[model samples]
Target chain A: MKKVRIGAGSGYAGDRIEPAIELLEKGNIDYLVFEALAERTIARENLDKLKDSSKGFNPLLEERMMRSLPIAKKKGIPIITNMGAANPESAGELICKIGEKLGLNNLKIAVIIGDDVMETINGYNTNLLETDEPLHTIEDKIESANAYLGADIIAKALTLGPDVVITGRVGDPSLFLAPMMHALNWSYDDYDKIGQGSVIGHLMECAGQITGGYFADPGYKDVPNLERLGFPICEVYEDGKAFITKVEASGGTVTTATCKEQMLYEIHDPSEYITPDCVVDFTNVTFKEVAKDKVEVIGGRAKPRTSTYKVSIGYRNGFIGEGQMSYGGPGAVSRAKLAGDIVKKRLSLRNVRTNHLQVDYIGIASLHQEASDWLENEPYEVRLRVAGITPQYDDAVKIGQEVETLLTNGPYGGAGDFKSVREIIAVLSILLPRDMVKTDIVIKELN
Target chain B: MKLREIAHCRAGDKGNTSNISVIPYDENHYEYLKQNLTIETVKAAFKDIVQGDIVRYDLPNIHAFNFVLYDALGGGVTTTLSMDIHGKSLSSIMCNINLPDIRD
Candidate 1:
């Protein structure tokens, strides 16, 4: 069994190349995985921004990954990423174009589709998988539908001699794990090996989670070179075990505690971790800190999988607007809460019904308000957050403007920051039956 | 059935559709809750408390239930926004159910 070096890149807002380029230049990694596409970034932009016809911020992220290809090719490293937000094909085509411009004729780009058919799937009448309401009734038209593709499609693309694979709606971990399966030629049913690889992917998906980004170590704050955080690297073996490490002399530490914290992320039950390909039993897994920057992972095993694939459905419901204000003064907490009431009252008087409204003091409890009994004390500063969506775009816009009015004469609460409000798009997730979904992997030669 | 137990419960679909799995605070008693509680009963209990139409289904041999509440938010699908920009809490509309009296 040959040792394969896998590198995972942390996803951040905007394009970042220095970290990945540094890894390729030094580590001589076999595979590079980049995870992008956060819900917050997507929700702020317009739908057209996601489409191939547009070259918005997301395309810039793809371009950043594409820029690394020339350097990667020089080092003979293959790259895979989920930078494809709404259009993987366009992203792939754009990558191929960049490869051509770079004069790398051998670049093979594979585009994975079938994940974007959310609208088509919603129209069909099928057994109500969960909701008795026919899928069509739940959605008039799907705004966006993406399939959380597993490693198999990526493995298939890698086997086809593609230097790069671009995918939309792939699980963040799958982006990194697929390369391991392809490099090792690991069987899909190899439960232990698959589970181990999945664990590695999980750790690396959120790049900083395994590093010191969320480290509880008291000294983490003093870790050197915070500006240039080094991404994580996985040294995978053929026996379904891997040691997660980072660049030598990297600024962050990879202790057992850090690795354990990463494992707990987005995890519901450690015992029954589900993925498209396998059910990873995280409870059986063990971790050992072998060195300063290394953590050995073992004991991962797979369980039977469900017959269906989880689908993320985004629909065109209506327009929404949100505005926030900062309050500072005596009784700021009370003042902010009162301001929220005033805004709601004014909107209702105008026959403008908002879907939701919330007010919170920054230092006080915002999410778990009822649970936070300590918020009774007045705080120095409070943030008033208000949000609403309506079928009529005009109504949503009006509500957004009304929130800005709070800064003028509406409330004497305190000084606050107000800016132009934007439109809110609707997003929903629905599961598609297994038989109805099939993944196709094709390798296209760079022109 | 204290609301706190399931109040922060998070549910999401796995495959290609929107099948939701509500994460109860206690996984050990998930089976007991599922067996005794049907979609109708759960919906009826909280119907007046929350918005949206209740839709539920039973899986084969798996003692769990999945439910989707249609138009639960005031504005239906359009009303709900992403968690990033907007700080408004969307899950507050759901009335918490207490199950202390039915404990084994």
Candidate 2:
């Protein structure tokens, strides 16, 4: 098999598509993968906006992805992304429309469904619920429930000849691994090879995370032109092992340290790094700096996946209000801390117990000094962020108004105001046993 | 009288700011857990186990409360696999507690 070139895009959430397009254009990579939503990225109002626009949550991803589909069609590179939150079929239809507009009506669009079990959980069994606690029957009341799908659906879609494959809530690594499986025709049971491909996808999923973007290496601090950092790319071999490197002349460097830093991100346990394809063993893995711009990742082991699929659930909850203020200058840290105390005391007196409160003096010399805290001598910003849940809307408003008042009478040498505090909806994530649910893929050839 | 609390119980070493997590065994008690397990309560609960000042965070989405227990475990999470070392399974234990009903 020829070297499978995979390109990953940059940015956390609501990022532009130009960087991803640039990488695909320059590298001529076979697959282009992008991630749009994560647990931390979901916003209530944003979700409502998507519903209003006939799109679901995180529609920006689909909008940007639609803009890139034309280019992807012209270049003959298949595009896969996780922009399908709450409504995968609708998002897929939008992509098809974009394809039609671009005169690429022959676009085969695949809608990966069955992951949206928010409304129909009863159709699936819950024998996977191992705990004794009576699981809430949320099938009827669930606002959103998306299954974290694996690469199998994506590979199946690709086989049906889709120009673009949009998924609801597939695992981040699965987005990259699906392309490899399609290209190599690897079976889901192929543990070793599948594990190898999974490791490669995991490394590149977080965009620039593997390329000094979040590295703690002092030498990497002076990396020039970070505003245009290049996203990471993987060169996979038939054996499943791959080397991670960025565009050769890209701004950031891909060193062993950078790769190691990225590896540690979100990995709670090295031995039990679970994924849809396999349980990757990061323990015996070895990283070798083969070249200045490349690092070889080897010795990743895979085990059987647990018979459960992690489900992200969001529900309607009580209202929550949050406010922030900034304190600058020499005594910024002390004043900010003091301000936070005042708010707490006032809230306590009013019997308003907040669900959460935070006071951070961002510019203290002791904090982030090693990361070149250049703002220490010039000016500093201390922010206080607070939130709470209340059934009464009046209570929520009162909390918001009180926190904003801390700026003038509570703390000196600082400027603060009450910002809008939105309602806090219940968003819960549960891992449903895989045996309980089924996935079906429907591919449509749009012409 | 400032009551020191177990604002949050995390399985990580002491540091300025670190990721603190708790898993509720039951979903129905999630709202109750959120109400009782305030940052102050979390701090007051684990004051003895932690060595530093407590700065609590609200993680509404995860249905868990987080706290930045500063200078607590030495160098924070980097010190050790705090999860393994703590060994208390506070998440399950907290779930067992009978929380007072706070619903309207």
Q: Evaluated with TM-score, which candidate comes out highest? A: 1
lDDT string, candidate 1, B1-104, tens digits: 54334322223322212223343334455565665555665565545423555665432122233455453333323333433222123223222444554555
Once fitted onto the true fold, the runs of candidate 2 whose alpha carbons sit more than 4 angstroms away are A40-53, A122-133, A137-141, A216-221, A327-342, A348-353, A356-386, A389-391, A406-418, B1-104
Worst 10 residues of 2 chain A by lDDT: A365-374
Q: How many steric clashes does model 1 contain? A: 23
lDDT of 2 by residue, A190-222 (tens): 878777777778788878767756432233134
What DockQ would candidate 2 receive versus the native complex?
0.03
Which parts of model 1 have CA positions greater than 4 angstroms off? A12-16, A38-46, A49-57, A119-122, A126-132, A216-224, A330-338, A373-377, A419-426, B1-104
DockQ of 1: 0.09
List the per-model TM-score of the A chain: 0.88, 0.85
Estimate the lDDT of model 1.
0.63
